[model samples]
Target: MGMTIALDAMGGDRAPGIVVDGAALALRERPDLRFLLIGDRARIEPLLVRHRRLSAAVELVHTSEAVAADAKPSLALRQGRQSSMRLAIDAVKDGRAAAAVSAGNTGALMAMSKFVLKTLPGIDRPAIAAVVPARRRPVVMLDLGANVDCTAQHLFEFAVMGEAYARAALGVDRPSVGLLNVGTEDIKGHEAVRDAAALIRDSGLGIDYRGFVEGTDIPEGTVDVVVTDGFTGNVALKVAEGAVRLMASSLGDAFRASLRAKLGYLFVSPALRALRQRFDPRLYNGAMFVGLAGIVVKSHGGTDAIGFSHAIGSAVRLVEEGTNDRITAEMRKIASPGPQLVAASS
Candidate 1:
């Protein structure tokens, strides 16, 4: 049977319209794909009438309510039982859909998904893992604002999950894993990071556990997966985003400075276009909430139809690759007795 994805149709900035458009775009690429679009039917039906193929593939689930963009996670969880975001997540939990895709409030989606689907058997907490552009290829980084405070074991688990993700998503046979730290030295970073490194190295998990990696290593692609706590990982992600924007803005300013610069831009335009395509953030719009029992992909709230389609594609890839099954099996390996985990000094 073809995959059915649950979409929080009213969750994004351009609701119903862009969501419908994105679904159409995804369907064009994968004709077998079907959608369970959860939102206000009145607003969504008009948009669907425009796309004949998508109209045929989509099943609308009506809900008047939607979680507000600025709503707190706690408040949304308490009050948003009937909201589109919550209902879409519920679809995954109830097996109405293979996975749920939402361009909603990140915290609310995470909170609802966890409450409904719960975590996998051995997972303590779910982490947000996403692919980021790197020198050689995209790198998988985790805990992207999911758990601000993570223990050594949490970070260790993140590494395991990340490794599996890299293999499934990036098609790498043996992806190298690294713990993010201020320096690559053993004594660097706080207690949790140090302990996590020790656990990965000594756990007999068969991971390519590269000891430690600095911030530069992320863009340099020093490791296939970089694991860190939510606070640091989120900060690093934001900084990289800001830097990309700054570069784009600065280049535009330079290109428009004078007629000579304009001429120069034309000469280099092809190379620049290639560069832009390689580093385009829209291509990597989805962040998978790994360790969840059912698949839940978080799309960027401000992304366009194409970006949202990419996010939907991400959910499809995970479902096809059986990512969650791989994670569950790997977790079982660590739980069994092979090599004792190295305890950190207090």
Candidate 2:
């Protein structure tokens, strides 16, 4: 009866095993939450048995088919409606689960979600959102591969969605937003961003549109949200990850360079590890496909139990906060303006 997360049991690279393990942890840790594991019952039940404590908190819904990791999403969906991903999505639509979580093929998950839940009344397409840790409050970033290319309008829409999310998660009233661009100048970007910036600046959408912010400023915490298209957003996400890894590796090498440095490392190793974990991109792996009709979180495909738990926890928070109602309200104000849409409907 409380918020339930319907997990795609046969998802990600690890499938039923790793996902089940995370579900076990979440159930043991959170008393109010429940789980519906959607996949082949034979495979999932045995896995759940191994974690006997989770037996009471989890239910299995059998789904025979599976959409493989690298298969074409649309094609997979058409041929594999009985797969775990589709079944899990259906649970949300059928009012059985408050949310759904999957680490399956990204395109397949999105495609099935778009079909099963459809878009919200005012949203044209949904975007993926990630919360990035900053020097201060975490920054909400989107569209993390929701749409490969996006219009300025789409970016603007993402801004609204990001603000709504930040407000709920960070308790940020009137969160300041920055458009991701090569430069901060108003005239510095392609026509899309320039036009989007003008619209966000003037629209008075209850979110603070703080002009443009570049990639370098993402971790600065000067801004609460960064808005961009999926192409740039995905690249930024990977770059931040790679940078962190390289920095950590370099630090290890430097620490072992000399006896004095080794002594220093012994003194500072704890602090350094803490800092590394704090900035680790892997720590912020789960992201919501924002602007959807229901709460759907997509996790990193290659994730361990720790990373997977983040996605489950995010789904719980999003569900409790009435994400759907807030999303619907935001989209209504900016419902794709066009006489053609109105005329077509008429």
Candidate 3:
């Protein structure tokens, strides 16, 4: 049977409509793919009728409740059993779908997904990993707001998952992994980061362990996989996003500064549009929750149909490539006796 993706049809800020439309967009790209749209039948059915092509490939599961945007994770965990988010996750856990996609409350989605699918064996906690467009090639960074506090061990696991993700998702043969820190030298970061770096360096886990990378190294494509705790990774991701937006905003202002500038805008518009596409967040909307037994992709809640389609595309990629299995294979390479941290010479 063709792969099916379970979707929370009423999860996002502009849901049901946007979700349906996004599914239609995805179907245009992958006609063999199928969808199980779980949400209000009344809201979803009407939209499905508008896209005859998508309607044939989709199956709607009526769900009356939805996890509220402001709902606390704990509240959703207890009260959202019948919600669209939970049901979508259930579809994946039940073997009815290959993966699940949601643009819902982040905390609630994570809570419910963990409760339903459970973490893969050997994983302490799931981490959010995403593809980043680096100068040389796409880079994979992990722990983007999944676990606010992570141990040195967690960072090591992130590296393992990230290396596999780079191979499966980005087609990197042997991805170079780096620990994000204040400086590249040994003894530059806190105990957790320093320890993680040392372990990776000496573990001989078949990973191309690059010593350490600073914040500036991310966009520079200094490493193929950047591993960090959730707190730092989230902050760095946000900063990079903000910087891109600022560049676009400044360009718009410069183009509208004067009549002469307007003339120049006409000549520069095409180049700027190309650059915008390269940095478009929608192209990289899907955030994969790694280290889970089942696949779950989180889309930005405020994203449009185009962005949501990309999230679904990401889910498709993970399912097709057996990303979880790849991660497991990589984890198996860690030596039975954990390697001791070897301090590098100053």
Candidate 4:
């Protein structure tokens, strides 16, 4: 028997259609996978007819309601009980699926997953972790818009979860972890970061803890995992993404500036194409809500079928790799009596 994943089929910018199409794409790659697609029967059924294999592998659960793109997290939580997004998460909570994937409202998805799945034993809050392109390899950064404000202990927990994530999802063995800050110096950041660093260092968690890393270090691949509060992580993510867009745009304009430049593009086109592929946002669509008891992947809302398929792929890997198990085991180590985590002074 294969692992089943619950999909919020009515949840994206282009609902039902892209959801079904993405599932079809994912099914081709992982034949053993099964799906519990939750959405409107009328819209989803027509798309399924085109992919007989997927239709066979899927069990559709009908729901006409869906959380709006702009819906507040609290409103969605209170009123979206019958929404496809909520129902799909419900499947995970009810043991009907091994994981849940959504291209829905980010806040709503995070809110619902936390409410339904709860956090792992040692975790106070679940953090949203995603892979970002780096110089050497992709880095896993967490607390991505999940909790804007966090305590030192919370950041410490994020490091533990992030290290486990790198090992499970990125195939990194003994991944190096870092606390994001203004400077590499221990005294530079606010008390929370300094304390989190101290906790990770003294806790004897066996994590390869790199003291501090700046925002520039993220793209430079200074560490395998970057841990921060959601507010900073979210801001850094947007800044990096915006920078990539700006660079791409500038390159395009330069290439079209003159006939000479256009001719020059022919020679660099292959290399540029390779670079584009390496940094394509679609390739890194899935953001895992780490620390949750059950797997939940949030796909980019505007992503196409290919991107959504990658998000599904992320869910498959997380389940197959037993990411939560790794987290639990690591957390247990900290809970044991060897070296207690030091409390940071407020």
Worst 10 residues of 1 by lDDT: 337-346
Per-residue C-alpha lDDT of model 3 across residues 212-311, encoded as one tens digit per residue: 9999889999999999999999999999989888987897898899999999989988998898799788898888989999999999999999999999
Tell me how candidate 1 scores on lDDT.
0.93
lDDT of each: 0.93, 0.83, 0.90, 0.93
TM-score of 2: 0.92
Q: Please identify model 1 stretches exceeding 4 Å from their true place.
A: 339-346
Pitting candidate 1 against candidate 3, the one with the higher TM-score is: 1
TM-score, candidate number 3: 0.95
Q: Point out where model 2 deviates above 4 Å.
A: 334-346
Q: What clash pairs does model 1 have?
A: none
Off by over 4 Å in 4: 339-346
Q: In candidate 2, residue 127 scores what lDDT?
A: 92
**Residue 204 CA error for candidate 1 (Å)?**
1.3
Q: Cα lDDT for residue 321, model 2? A: 75
TM-score for each model: 0.96, 0.92, 0.95, 0.96
Clashes of 3: 0
